[model samples]
Target: MGTVLITGMGRGIGRELARVLLRRGDRVIGTVRDERSISGEWSEFLASGQLRMLVLDVRDETAIRKAAAQVDEPIDVLVNNAGIIGPQRQSTLDMDFEGFLETLNINTLGPLRITHAFLPHLRRAKAGKIVTISSRMGSLSYAKADRIAYRASKAAVNKVMQGLAEDLRPEGIVAISVHPGWVRTDMGGTGADISVAESAAGLATLIDRVACEDSGGFFDWQGDRLPF
Candidate 1:
């Protein structure tokens, strides 16, 4: 019934989010970096109806614009789920500079680029919702990290969405940042506490129930507001 766009649908939360949305009868346009090479549960989702994949690399501004162009159905919801964990287990002081730059490009700049391309569409919808998939590791208040690149990139995303919410309130489009919990995905690792479906589903409910006043805040999958 509603048209929703999600990025990084190839796996993890993005893939589960697409499945959940489609099962609810929403038209889900999911973004992937490759059209030909697909695998795992994601390929199964692609084979089914209610979900469609478009080759999209969020680091490419032109690709994001092209993705927005294909979203003819006045996008009601936009989820910036595309992100990278980068080279793992590197501390901030010992972090590789090149890896940090790559992480920032995919996780931080990617969301900003996509939001910019789709803001006009969201504004036209007038009462749209934009949820940026962030992490608790992003929080400066809770920041204690081994993966510096991932944490820092998500922190940057948090700030970007926070600023966007202030500017977009007048347009009636709500933008909220979410930490999907420590989900048991590739990024979250095997020791994580929550499952991907659990995180994605809970976030969906939170997004649905989000008040205008909730804009510019960061929250966990349980809908608890996190410190800035």
Candidate 2:
């Protein structure tokens, strides 16, 4: 039973990942913007002692560091899953600048901040891991026409994960990014093909198998290699 820390755990893929990890007997430290945002059933998870909730906004680096310091148990894994879709689907010309910046703050830059906070803690563990829940939409090699802002932010996230994989290697810390498919969620939309449960389960399997040698690559939910 490993101790895993997950950000953006209020809902969607993050919440599902927490549930699956807890079911497998892993201790989960779930971070959200606020504790009140946690649902009733989640309280039961906390009560059961497999889950702990922390208040943290992805955009806030201060909170990430402070929370990391509060963690007494050693963390075996860190999952950076907090992200946001750009406000309204529009062409790049139509996208608001502030909205675009917010997307970067949450989707790309958030992982960097959280990972920085947890790095030392992870290094202390014998074998640590960091998984950034990335999107295939980020692939510069396979860029599509629309959703420019979201796509650009994810691309940035991909690079961040790659750099992290290199930086953490000497410490025996594995860092990799995951493509969870187009999951059905607030972010993925109803038209998406995969359910959050299905996607999270696949991602957990991928994360579980992330060895040190696999650190700087991108993989899909099914553990197949994804194009950069």
Candidate 3:
């Protein structure tokens, strides 16, 4: 079993992913925005030292660094899951500039910041992997205009992950962006196609088998390749 760090484990996909990993005997280091996000279900795991929780906003670089300092062990996987769906007024013509910026900060830049803060710990691992939870809506082939801010932010982050994969290739580190499917979550809404359990299970299996060749590529929850 390995240690996996997941951001935004308060609820939804991130929480589910943490649960799946922990149950499979992998140590989980989950991050939430605050103490209130902590769930009573995780009490046993936390007490057993199988789970570690870090409270920090991904946008705050200082907070991320401080949290990273507390973890001295190697992290096998870093899952960048914390993100926002963007403002209600996130259309191409009608956009809330401030809200758009916040979306970019959380969705696009947050993963990079967290990855940077935990680089040393990841480097200590045998084969560190960076998996950023991105959306298929960001695909360039799709000309969809809905939620422009969210789409733009995800697209930007995908590019960032690709670049990271290239730069870290020589070191044997793997980085890939993932489309977690239309999961039924707060962000995905109730009408979404798949349940959280289904999506999370697929994601966990996909993450388990990622190799160096998978780096710089984008894949869905089912481990199928997608066009970037």
Taken over the whole model, the C-alpha lDDT of each candidate is 0.84, 0.88, 0.96
The candidate scoring highest on lDDT is 3
RMSD of each: 2.2, 1.2, 0.5
Roughly what TM-score does model 1 have, to 2 decimal places?
0.92
Q: Please report how far candidate 3 places residue 128 from its true position, in Å.
A: 0.3
* Weakest ten-residue segment in model 2 by summed lDDT: 87-96
Which candidate, 1 or 3, would have the higher lDDT against the true structure?
A: 3
lDDT of 1 by residue, 74-165 (tens): 77788999887887546866878888899999999998998898877777674788899999888998848678888889899999999989
* TM-score: the better of candidates 2 and 3: 3
Per the 3 Å backbone cut-off, how many clashing residue pairs does candidate 3 have?
A: 0
For model 2, what is the error of residue 170's alpha carbon versus the real structure, in angstroms, after optimal superposition? Answer: 1.1
Clashing pairs in 1: none
Give the TM-scores of the predictions, in the order they appear. 0.92, 0.96, 0.99
